[model samples]
Target: MELYVRLNDSTDKDYAFQLPENATVNSHIKAIFSTSAARIKQRVALSDLMVIRPSIFHEYEPVEYYKSTHPGHLTEGGCLIFDYKADRKEYLEKLDYEKPLIDQLWPGQLIVPQWRMSKKYVAIYVAIMAAWLYTDLPDCISPTPGICITNQLSRMLIPILEKWGVQADLVNKLREEITPNYNSVAAQWAFFGLHVLKVLFTTFFFYIAMANPFSFNPIKMYKIRNVAITQKNEKIQALLKYLGWIGARRATYDDYQTNYYDYIIKKFGGVVQAYRAGAIKRAAAPGVPLGAGEGFQTPLEERFTGNTFKRIDEENPKFILSEEYFCELENNLKELLDEADGNIGRMNAEIRRFRRYGIYEPSEKLKHVVDVRKEIYIKDKEIAEAGKTADKKRD
Candidate 1:
């Protein structure tokens, strides 16, 4: 089973497998170290440490039996937790299995504008239409003037709609609905003419409102197209400073992406100690007697060296199994996963979910992850191939 492992202070997310029944801890560790020597070396001093665990059914037993000798074997992170609970067979097989908190949560994106359209902007649009309706005069009864006003308002609205990147056909239908009056050819012409004028007026004012140092008279600026170099340079510098501040953060040694597996192992002790005492079995005489087993034969001659795995028991105080901490952590992770899943699902559902709705443009962070995975995949494939070649040579 694939388990997501996050290392401390590292952007590198990795997946580790839960050893199947056929696989022994010895075989798994050896395989992992052999294939990923550099990565394993960075995280663990494999020669010293041993990783250990008991059967799933016997998880509650105290004093974990190690498969190898070691002080501790490094995990993906400084601390390790299973991210996907449903994938856990023991938990999933139960009829009462509640989905992990992580499964229900969503992760949000780092985006400049969280909203596609602002509420304030929408309110302004509505207010403008409402205010116009309220100002309709009592004496102006003719359909011609009404149609002219409606068409003019529509012409103004349509262009603004286009500028804000909305569908124009909808705006046109809205325009027709708002007018709801038809008259003579003269009225239609008046309406058309007035709409053209309103469109020009709205466009002009809109530009004025948005533009800095508004060029109310663009005709004059159009004639003098040659802009000053110093002015341009100043603008460029301002832009650079703006962007730099936005991107800048104080860097620290701790902030550097780390292999957490390496960090945990290093911090705990040397690799040999972790593995040898923690996991590995040294050959011992089967007849050797311990005080407790004086009357009976020892179940196994070899003892586990490393004590990596722990069982939840009464003496342990059940702190790790506490609902509050586990639930919180599980929920947080689930939220992140769910958010990613939701975004991808939404994008697929609505072809235009992201800017301009084109397929294959993922976030830069996602692209970085993809690149890292490719590198890891290539490295792993090479290691496997080399192992095969070495076995052949020995044969």
Candidate 2:
């Protein structure tokens, strides 16, 4: 039986294996590392591998049963996905439970609220009030001033009347009842009366400010809590947009239009790319090879000469591959190839459906599908080349 298998790591290459019907999924995964010419075989462990059945709408299922069983039965065009068990576990563990439920359903990190006001605004307010008190107080307090100064000064003096228990209601009532002509001598008296009333109101405001009767805490005034939270939410939304999570639709209050899977997809991309990058970065480290510069032959060259190099500590208790292992690997590889083909077909169908409906806008889903198909093509070619190399080594 022929099978298809996709490695969970960077390169994400799919390999084809020829296997017997009695081989188990576990044995098959181990055989790929032991027999294949792929470089990933050196980095991944058989114990950490999981085999899953790829599907369209449903989450992939792990093929725990043997190939001979009803549930474990492998079909043509079926795809068996291979991934690192540790990665799945770690991803699940890293989710932010403390965030609101809605935020968790969306892409982007949760923004925690830390409320406070900027020192600049606080300083500006203080400076404005200080200028009024220092620059205008003397003119208002002078004994002989012009009509405008006297009116303003009396307005400023209203606080003393209020503090002395004069009812603002009675003062306002008297002012309204008594009218004076501006051209007459009584106009000065009328203006003084109006200032006294205004002073009383000003005094009330001063009292309120000093005593804080409404409990308007100055410290709290400095922090625009609501604005801070809103700004943080917008910042996260902007970041998600940059990462391709916003999709074709503009982000809105409606959750249905948003593509929340970008974070997970990007994460998978990172995992797929990390191994090769890390290996190259850590090439000088103890376990990895220094390559041609160190006068050392590659792992594949050493393997052909019947020489065994020290394996990474993670793969210490390596399982020896048998004929059954190879058979199972081959069967799984066939399944993975089938799944990939099925996905391409489904994507093509969806694209056709959209076109039939007269929708010409480029769909994010279509783009993703096209990319996947391209990757599948590359992986299929790689699998064929690796198989040929393996055959040559055997010959």
Cα lDDT tens digits, model 1, 33-89, are 222334333322221121111111111112211111111111111112221221222
lDDT of 2 by residue, 1-395 (tens): 33333332211223333344444333343333332223223332221122221211112233222111011101111111122221232222222323332222111111111113335644654575544433323223424333344345555556666778789986564443332232344554555556556655654554333322211355544432332423456543443232222122111111211222232234346544545445222212111111121111112223233211112112321211223323343454344345556687755543332212112122333223223433444566799999999999999
Please identify model 1 stretches exceeding 4 Å from their true place.
Answer: 1-119, 131-147, 150-232, 245-395
- Could you say which candidate leads in lDDT? 2
- Model 1, CA-based lDDT: 0.31
Error of 2 at 226 (Å): 28
RMSD of each: 26.9, 28.3
